[model samples]
Target chain A: MVRAEGLTFYYERLDEEGNVESKKRAVDHVDLHIRPGKFIAILGHNGSGKSTLAKHINAILTPAEGTLWVDGMDTKEEEKLWDIRQDAGMVFQNPDNQIIGTVVEEDVGFGPENLGVPTDEIWKRVEESLDAVGMLKYRHHSPNKLSGGQKQRVAIAGVMAMHPRCIVLDEPTAMLDPNGRKSVIQTAQRLNREEGITIILITHYMEEVVEADHVFVMDEGRVVMEGSPRQVFSQVEELKKLRLDVPQATLLAFELQKRGVRLPDGILRNEELVDELCRLKSKM
Target chain B: MSIKVKNVNYTYAEGTAYEIHALKDINLEIPDGQFIGLIGHTGSGKSTLVQHLNGLVKATSGRIYFNERDIYGENFSMKELRSKVGLVFQYPEHQLFEVDVLSDVCFGPRNLGCSQAEAEKKAREALHMVGLGAEYEKRSPFELSGGQKRRVAIAGVLAMEPQVLILDEPTAGLDPKGRDEILDQIESLQKERGITVVLVSHSMEDVARYVDRIIVMDHGEVRFDGTPKEVFRHYKELEKMGLAAPQMTYLMQGLREKGADVDADATTIEEAADAVEHWLKSK
Candidate 1:
């Protein structure tokens, strides 16, 4: 679980004389609360501070103004840093930069080994983690031989090996193809549903966010909107004004509604839209 | 100028244990003023095949002809070939090293031995084409937004005035709005300049909506090459190769399976809407 109050972060540019020439508030007075065992999605444009806010959840960036707590442990406490990080894990966008181990099994074991897990237990955790991500068959192979999607799943397995209560993924599917994207999202959902691990997925993909239990839309360093996926996606114009988009089916339904077809909003999936149209035809 | 590939075969680290047949015997022709979309799952040799277009990677066997001249033949100017066939790698914003946007864009022209004035003029034109203006010329390329930085990188290649432009996942990390903005600019620029454009991407929706032709690669081979409708018609085959058609196409297919009389050829949302409206009217 994660909670924040008036969370504010500033990025400063120093002049040649070491004085702060200009300061930009990357995250401005954002308040948020995330419950345990729930899948949450954060959507935003490029400079909307979604990634900046994600850093706060994992203690990667401490609050510059207000307070943030991960698992009830204040990130500001110096001694609690390790405990906070142990409670929450972070995955980044680039697959190549995060992976260090050459072999797949060894890579997944690095996190637990760093946490001082015992030799025998590290292998056990690695096997379980890789199996959770459906990569157990690739245990002995080099990670370099895997595809981008497979490499990302291995990254998630590495994070899982640490046994963190929450995992924060920052645009994990941005570098992948559609199939790869589906594989990564399904894995995350399975982690949340079956394993009860908390998931905070930060991405720009509208379709991927449709399956989330809660959706938070951020813009210009502020939490502009927050609700269930249906509640948020129904306001198509508001999201469009914020330079974001709803799922394709949702957009199509909205467009059809504008043409006087009298369809309901928040149609997240293709099957839902098709069924709606078929019902309308039957009524006619 | 058109590009012709004849029985091209490319092997990486050939004759070694680690050798990879990155491209198998491929034959294709790309005409001038055409827009192409290259789609493949990762490690499917799409990147390997594009590198051959600009002479970055030589073929292990077979030949590539650019405008009827063999690229591997003697007296063929690789330098000229590079300028005339610009290829922008994925995440090209990392390659912007110059302090300011204008200088960064001008680097390609300057490297080609153009004078400062000429390079600056071309860079200005290129930036303008990508929807930037004079205000961005003096600003640091690093300070711009992600979409703007990508546009600046594209301008860097555009300053060379290439006859053919190849972009590998140009909109990879951008948000929807930024992706649409960049793709729209590229589309208009291709039309305005009449240059051959090859876009390598993973988004079936984007490629289906914009490209004139679609080329599908699978395991170092050109599996299919045709119009977007033709390629997407075999959506099942594509799914087997870890690929898929646009969401609209799938929706239409689902409708037909559900006993609705919907046309399955709709690749875009507008076309799907029209088909659905027609069906509703008939009912």
Candidate 2:
């Protein structure tokens, strides 16, 4: 589990004189608690500080004015930075930037190797991790030659090899196609379900968010709304005002509701909407 | 310009130890001003085929013609071909290194020997085409949001005023709003400028919704090419190739199997809605 209290981050800009000319808070007065073993989706428009919040979960960016703890380890402690990162692995948006190893299997093993895991066990972890992300078939191939989706899966496998209790994926599917996106989401879910690792998926795709047990909506560097996906997406107007869109089916269903059709709220999938319409027609 | 590719065969690093038959005996014709959606799983030779369109890469065998002129044939300058077929690579931002957004966008036009002022004007217009404003010109590319930075990179290619624009996953690494904006801009560009468009994407739903024609590739060969409905009709085979049919198409197919009188060819939500409504009214 993770906890934050009044966390704030400032990006300090200095003039030529070496004095801080100004400071802009990227994350402002944010309080959060991520329960262990839950698949949570964080939704926000760009520059909403969601990425900043994700960084805090893994101690990538320590809080400037507040406190954060990962699994009871304070992130502010210098020695705990590595421990924090080990406890909650971070997967960034760009797979090309994170992958250092030339070969696929080697890339996945780099994390465990860096952690001083035994050589025999490192390969085992690497294989398991790659298999988890469906990248094992490409284990012998070069990372540079892989597709965006494959490379990202390798990145996830690299993080998985670290054996973190939780994985913080910052826009993991942003660069992927719909197939890649689905695979990545399914992998994250599998990790959460099978491996019992906590998952924090930060993305802007409303359809992907529908499957999450908990959803947090952020705007202007604050957690503006937090609830289940149905609870969050049911309020279509508020999401729209926040510059976010509901799932397409949900939006269409909402539009139909406004047109005097009594469809249910928070229709996540097209099948659900179709089924609802079919039932309505049966009554006639 | 129309492109006719006949039995094109290409291999990366051919004769070398790492030679990959990235493309094989592929033949296709891109009619003038046609909007083509190129879809495939990873390593399906989609990238290889696009490179041949603008002469970025020569086919190991076979010939490419642009309106009866051989692509590799004399009298067809590679520079002219490049200017005609503008390719925006997948990670376009990797190529940007100028001091400001304006300078970055002008890089392509300036390289083509346009005057500084002319390149700057082209940059401005290109930025506008991608929905960026003149105010973006002064800002540092790194300081802007990722989506904004991507638009600047796209504008750099658009500034060349290419007749045939090819985009490789232009909406990659963007949010939904950003994706919608980019797709809308591409759609408008195809309509307003009447430019030939080749959109390379992995999203079956997006391609099914927008593209006039869909080309499916598998293992470095053209597996299928036709309208979206025609390609998606082989839903089982596409799935076997690690691809998915569009959601609406899948839904309609499932409904028909469930005996719900839905049209399997309905690809978009609007079309599906209309089809379902019509079916319901008939019932």
Candidate 3:
């Protein structure tokens, strides 16, 4: 439920006298439309403007040129800012920076409570959100004592308690270990599938994007590519040139194809690559 | 030239209600000039173990020896040990407090008693090694991009010219290209200087691609210690421990399970491709 048209944002660099010296365009003229309940992934390298684009979705930064609307509410309109943010919640990379409450249950409830949700209803929403992220058992425990994965789940629960229609995770798994990464991605997927919540995941991890409904590749502040996972991953060389990566299985399949092996492109999963190779072996 | 850990046991908040055993009876022997990958899930004691290597954290009970001399010995110089075993921590950019990139890199050498001129020379060399040229020397550390900032932080450690370098999740939060750049620099530096390098990371692909040895830690103990191929052979066990082998390992395993005449021990994409091609030709 997010849309953008010619969305452009620039960071102004001021000189010694406080005069604007130059402007660096963080987000170029980019267009995007995210349907409700769709799981979308945005991939790019450092300084590629993917994070800048994510900020626009939650009204954290308004577009310098053109327009952005979340749930049909224009982000530029002052009165609609709060509504826009409520509709699209944002989760950043660092859990420690986002998590402020001492206790897990209190952290999850803080979001809804700030939205003026009733005390009793806040607790109810807290329970549901924690349960959704599979952290209900830790509701009473101190968040500082939890592991990185558990703490991230608590952060997601906090966002979920706000009842946002869309959730934008900006590299939530960057600071996590392998298990932590898997758990957080699974939590996002479950919310997308069972709760019908729109998911906008921005990450450098290609494996995480394999299961996304739609994938958008950004570079130099522009949307260079946008398609289904298969369509985007099929261009291994292009992705590499853009300073991004494909899944390891996809890369292996691409290498084989380059060596004159008759294999299909864009093999996302290990099993798919194995099955394909086996089929080829049988033909041989 | 070597680091040896003997029955190291580290406990946090000892004798308190929150006492936690951070490290078990850990024993490890690191020889000279080896590229090592240290991996574990969150709170698995990888960080704690690395901190012990450079004498940052004292073990509750046990001994550590660097260059065959006990680090805990009264005659041993902890400052000297720290200089020789440089540690680039997680989020190392947070340690950058100097105004400019050059001065930031110079801090470590300066702290080690190098004169300003000597430190500047070493800092410039270190910056060049990390691929940051002289043009970036004058820029503010805060004004640089994330990757550049990370490189400057790394250069801060490299300027010390440590015989053993330990990096904890150095590439965390970086893009793929940035990750590759930093890792390649570290690998080359290790090779060129013939120095020991221990990389603590969460990415299986990275460890598989670079390290000569892989040490898997679980519950404050070393669960597996061997070469990448050897350690990754226990992929199923790794997964159970909240860790995993590289995706290539799984692909090879999947191929073998599907009755393809391919080896399942390949840990890298090139190796996996070679195995599949060999199998196809044989067929």
Candidate 4:
């Protein structure tokens, strides 16, 4: 659903006189392609340009050089801006910032209403979107009164109401508690699995990325690694060098391997690790 | 030096239609020079309880004693209490306002009526403690990275030389490496200074790795309080409260459930690895 070719973006630091003092490349010569209806994760440290790259998907920030296409439409095309945004709805880090309406239902309906969807269709979309995110029961509750996870689900519903082909969640779980994080991640997974919506999740948490169909590790404004979850997480040392981390289970499995226990690489989940250990025990 | 809370209850908008009991009859004792993890889900009253420790929010009905002195007693100095009990708020980078990093760190000590030289000395010391050296002194706080800006904000609080430091989700938005750097700096600073450190966090792995004691709050009450292993043993209960044990704990439990002989109480990665190796050797 998304493709980029040598995408380069830089922020110009202006001096006192409005002249460019220096240019800092936030995303440099990055080439990546995200297939339709797949769960994708982008991992990077702070200021590593992951967010800068994600902004290009929704046409929020245009590339200074090279090009990015969302669903085959070039993001730099002004006429395609709104359509590109409609194709890839963006959910930001802070739920409080994205949510604008006082009530949850009203908030979810705002997007469809903006698209000039009829009032009846808008209400219909709101119900379906909220139901998809499992927030329909809270339709009338004040957005401020909801928990962080609930508020984020409402935010996702707002984006889903736009009928985007893909959703770009930029660190959506950064501010959430453990349960909140789980709920949000599960919501994203369900949207990808059941709704066939492409999910591009940018996050610092490694656990959230383990289940993704593909993973991209970015550092210093470039894609340092790209592969399946298992393939990427197997290189624990490389990920660490990029200032990222593997999931705890994977780390534990790696440590066991170091200590002379025969364990497979990139153990993504707790059950997988347990099963592998048990299989080893059976051999013993 | 030490803090004691007795029968503390806090209600927001009391006597109004929106009255909500944020905290309920909370009781605890924090001895000096200890690392404590204060954990709870959002709106679980962990923040409310920490605010009470530093006298930022007064309990509706309770008493607090700091260093054997009743904080609510007549002639008690709230200002003195504040300086001694430093609070580093969430997204503290937003609290940075001074023109330069050094000036920002010095703001706290200077406000406490220290001479300029003394304040600069304290600021430099605090900056060094947070791993920011003189090379960062003249740089504007606004120009620093997210992690650096957060460190400067923490330095602002540390400059006060507080005996008790309370951090509220200090690593909320930071990346994995940045989170580790900040937490490690705090850990070392706590050990060197021997000051009581209360880290309020949502990451179970961090709390298990760093703090000596874990206090679990739920519904405005202390649900569980013990060492990491002790509290994480109640992971089922924690799950019900919108919390969880570290991933290693779950892995250990999963191993045991699958009929493998393993210590399920292991909370950290190192501990779990040791347990698994021991089991493997026995086989």
Candidate 5:
């Protein structure tokens, strides 16, 4: 379980007069909780503090005020920082920046190696991680020659080898192509369903959020909304006013409703909208 | 102007021990005034292909023709090609190094040997083209937001007055609103300026929405070349290649497979909805 209560963070920004500003709160008095074994997607515009929240989960940055607890372990404890990071692995945006070793397998093993897993165990972890992401065939291949999705999978494998209970992906698909995005999402979903690991996906893409179990919407460094996919998407205009937009299917449904289609609210997927339309027709 | 690459083959670090077959014996033609979308997984030679258009990379074998003239000759004026075909690299904003936005935009045209006044004028015009106002002229490029800085970078390229503008993932890091703004601006430029556009993107959805034609690449080969609708219609092959149909396409197809009357070939969410409504009424 993950719990954050009244969390606040600040960064200093200088003013026009060259005097240091008091503080800029990247996240302010935010309270949130993620139950174990659920796919939670975090949606926010750029610089809206979703990434800040993500960094908190992996203990990369501790809260300046309030508290955060991951699996009942206090994030403020410096001694447990490494374990916290291992418990909640992070996959950053740039896949190129994450992968270090020359060979794919060797690079994946680097994470476990740093965690002090033995040489043989590192290989075992590497194989398993690669298999999880479906990149085991490219184990011996050089990373420089791999596609963006393949490279990202290798990055995920690096994180997976650590055997974290939760994976926090911060705009991981932003730098990838459509193909890369699909493979990465599928792998993350599989890991969540098959391995029972929790996924905290931070992204701007609306479509990516459609499959998520629960979602939190952020604006101006605070959690303004949280609900299932249907609940969040149902508030189309509210999201739009916050500089956030719905998936194309959701928007089209909203438009259809506007045109007096008599569709129900909170249709998240095209199939649901399709099924609803068919039902309306049958009833008519 | 048109660009034609015939039997092009290249390898990175060819003579050295670390060689990569970046491109195979490729043949393709980019017609004048056509908006072409290029898609590939990383290392699929899409970047390599665009680089050849503006003479950024030389083919190790075969020929490249610009209109009726062969451009791969030894005496090629890469300088001229740079003028005719402008390439906006990924995160083009990060390449902005000048102190002021105006100076930054002028750098490209000035380097191309335009008079200082001419370059400045073109720079201002280009800035306006990307929707920047007069007040933004004095601000540092570094001070701008990610989306604004990207437009500035594109303006810098526009100042060079290229016949074809090649954008590589121009909307990569943008939010939805920002992405639409950029894509809409690109579409307007293509229509108003009538410049051939080569859009290098990974998002099939973005390509499906904005571009007229699509080229799919894999392992240094052109796997599929067609209109966006035609390309996305092959859903199984696309998935097998580690690619995804646009979200709406996938959903529509999945529902169709499950015996729903939704048109599986809808390429956009809006189109998918229209197809559904039509089918519903007909039923």
Candidate 6:
């Protein structure tokens, strides 16, 4: 659903008079592609340009050089800005910032209403989106009264009401507690699986990325590593070098292997690691 | 030698239609020079309880004693209590406002009536303690990275030379590396200076690895208080309150649940790895 070739974005330091003083390349010559209906995760540390790169997907930042296409439309095309945004809905990190309406249902319907969707269809999409995120019962509650996770789901529902083909969530769970984080991830997974909406999740949490079909690790404006979760996590040392951590189970499995335990590589889940240890114990 | 809370209850907007009991009859003893983790889900009254320690929020009922002195007693100096108990709110970088990093750090000490030289000296010491050297003294705090700015903010509180430091979610919004760096600096400060540290965090792994004691709050009450292992043992109970144990704890619990002959008390990755290895070898 998305493709980028040598995509370069430069953030300019503006002088007092609005002249560009200097330019820093936030995304540099990165080649990336995403298949429709697949869950893709982008992992990077702060100032590693992950957020900068995410902004490009929604045409928030036009490329200073090279190209990025969302669902066959070039983001650089000013005329297709609305279309590109409609194709790839964006959910930002802070739920408080994105949510504008006082009531939850009204907030969600705002997205569809903006798209000039029919009034009847807008209400229909609002209920379905809220239902999808398991927040339909809270439709009448004020956004301020909801928990962090619930607020974020309402934010997601707002985006989903736009009926986008893909959703790009930029660190959506960063501000949430563990339960909120779990619920948001489950909502994203369900959207990808049940609704067949493509998902691009940017996050700092290693555990959240384990289930993604594709993982991209970015550093210094570059995609340093790209692979399946198992393939990427297996190289524990490299990820650590990038100042990223593997999931606890993967790290534990790696440590066990280091201590002369004959465990298999690329253990991703808690059950997988425990089962391997159990099998080893039985053999012993 | 400590902060003591007895039967403390806090109600916001009492006697009004919006009256809400933010904190219940809570009692806590925060001993000196100890690292404590205060953990709870959002709106669980963790923040309310911490605010009471430094006298930021008065208790609706009950009393608080700091260093054997009742904080609400007549002749008690609120200024002295605030200076001795430094509370760093979440996103403390927003608290930075001075022209330079040094000036910002000096703001707290200067406010306490220290002369300019003494305030600068304290600022220098605090900055060094937070791992910022003299070279960064003149740099504007606004120009620093998120982690660096956060360190400067913490330095502002540390400059006051408090015996106790309380930080609310110091690692929030930071990347993994930044989070570790801030926590490591805080840990070393607590160790080297013998400053009492109360870390308010949502990350179970961080609390497990850093703090000596964990206080689990739920519904405005202290549900559990013990060492990390002891508190995390009630992971099932925590889950019901919208909280969870560290990932390693979950792994260990998962092993036990699946009938594996492994101890489920491991709270850290290294401990869990060693436990699993030992279990395998013994088998």
Candidate 4 C-alpha RMSD relative to the actual structure = 0.9
Name the 10 consecutive residues with the lowest summed lDDT in model 2 chain B.
B274-283
lDDT of each: 0.93, 0.87, 0.93, 0.94, 0.88, 0.92
Candidate that beats the other on lDDT, 4 or 5, i.e. the better one? 4
TM-scores for chain B, in order?
0.99, 0.97, 0.98, 0.99, 0.96, 0.98
> DockQ of every model listed?
0.80, 0.40, 0.87, 0.89, 0.52, 0.73
Model 2: chain B TM-score relative to the native chain B = 0.97
> What DockQ does predicted model 2 obtain?
0.40
Best by DockQ: 4
TM-score of each model, paired residue for residue: 0.99, 0.94, 0.99, 0.99, 0.91, 0.98
Q: What share of the true interface contacts does each candidate keep?
A: 0.67, 0.29, 0.88, 0.88, 0.55, 0.66
Of candidates 5 and 3, the better by lDDT? 3
Greater-lDDT candidate between 4 and 6: 4
Q: Which RMSD values do the candidates have, in order?
A: 0.8, 2.2, 1.0, 0.9, 2.8, 1.3
Preferred candidate (TM-score higher): 1 or 2: 1
- lDDT (10s digit) by residue, model 1, range B1-283: 6899999999889899999898999999999999999999999999999999999998999999999999999999999999999999999999999999999999999999999999999999999999999999999999999999999999999999999999999999899999999999989978988989999999999998899999999999999999999999999999999998999998999899999887889898888888888788884
Worst 10 residues of 4 chain A by lDDT: A262-271
The complex in candidate 6 yields a DockQ of: 0.73
lDDT of 2 by residue, A7-106 (tens): 9999898999999999988899999888999999999987888998898898878999889999999999998887788889989888889999989999
Q: Please give, for residues A14-132, the per-residue lDDT of candidate 3 as tens digits.
A: 99999999999999999999999999999999999999999999999999999998989999999998788878999999999999998899999998888999999999999999999
Which 10 consecutive positions of candidate 5 chain B have the poorest summed lDDT? B254-263
Model 1 spans > 4 angstroms off: none
Off by over 4 Å in 6: none
Scored against the true structure, residue A36 in model 2 reaches a CA lDDT of: 94
Cα deviation of B24, candidate 5, in Å: 3.9
lDDT tens digits, residue span A126-238, model 6? 99999999999999999998889999999999999998999999989877888999999999999999999999999888999989999999999999999999999999998
